[model samples]
Target: MFAVHRSNGLRFLRSGTRTAAFQVRHSSTFAVWNPPKQAPREVPTPLVLCSASHWDSGTRNNIPQIFATMLAEKGHTCIEVDFGLPGDGEMCSSSQDLMDRLSEELKVNLHLSGSPFPPVIFARGFASLIAQAYISSHPAQGLFLISPPPSNTSLFPSILPTPLGEFDYELKFPVAVMACPTEMVQLRKHSRLGQDELVDLIEIDNLEGRDAFLRIEQWLDELGI
Candidate 1:
């Protein structure tokens, strides 16, 4: 159960280093965890794409799940894309056709609903490739990559498949890469996300920990978006 509390007509929910104030309502069964103070600061919608094999099945304490729970606790909904493994047990062929189709799927399905504030995209696994394909060209408030595969690597075998080269995208927004120690090494050796301006490379011991989420919140504060 949530450790929810109310005081002086304001409902307080704890998330990371900040507390979000939800509107006090007695009759509603469900209350949105939107922060009242963030209204003026523009809290962008949390857009997440967790690459995995049926992660939302209520079985694992994965990073995406943890992040989603934190969002739920704070009265924010996580808009996520479910990209699971192929049923046939075979990766798709690396081809331009596949990239175009997935790109279209991402564009059509994901909507910018935060109104005047753009979304901060959070992508992991092969979904990171899809997000990269779009965000490299389009605009966003920020991009948070969680344990992404080496850039230009054939993660799904269709979009920019094969280890083409080091990542060389000229991103227009801030970026944060949260990786485990091993992932940190791989990413440092193969990606340019850490070296770029306004990009942060964070090493996390446990992705499901409050500390990791807190670091991200601090990064968001730095972004001021």
Candidate 2:
């Protein structure tokens, strides 16, 4: 359970005394966390950015925060951004516009971390599209997409339907997709991206807390991160 409160246009959610939280807002609300400043550095530390349409601005309904904290515990700096509510601008934006804005946000976060290697992107639900588009233009160190739609058309009606095969062309870095049994079936059937040489598929009932974090660390270790 998480307690939610708001102050200074930022929301706070406390799962317990140990979960460090900080929130900032732009066109979207971004919650960021890192290991304590005094903590020893993790060589080649990961910069993780998470987003999910199902999440709200606070911990009470925050999938992003859960994922963020989990990654932070693994010695990565994590940031979660909520792009308003689900379906907010899904109706009007062309694929080009979506890619442009997504790339901008990614660049900003990348600069903030200033990591020599590209950051790992973690996205769920509708936010997976944003992760996909960003990876298309800017190769990441890795990508972990949770519960992404099987098709671009299913993801957003405004964009033309495209097979996952085409998206895989842009993914030169390591990638992983985690989805529930039902969504995983459709994703595997429709998206050829999951079959790429650099891609791995993980089936999980839900990606939260310690298990998810351990899996991510294992994946990153294999990638030599």
Best by lDDT: 2
**Tens digit per residue, CA lDDT, model 2, 49-147:** 656433322323356677666556555666666654323444434555554575566566556544566777887765777777777777677888877
Best by the TM-score measure: 2
Q: lDDT of candidate 1 vs native?
A: 0.57
- Candidate 2, 189: how far from true, in Å? 0.5
Prediction 2 TM-score vs. true: 0.73
Writing each residue's lDDT as its tens digit, candidate 1 over 1-225 gives 255443336455566534433332221111233333443343456544444333223334256545755664554445444443332444556534344455445554454223344567777765666677667566677888887776655343453443344345677788889888998898887677755556788998887688988987788678764
Clash tally, candidates in order? 1, 0
CA lDDT scores, all candidates in order: 0.57, 0.62
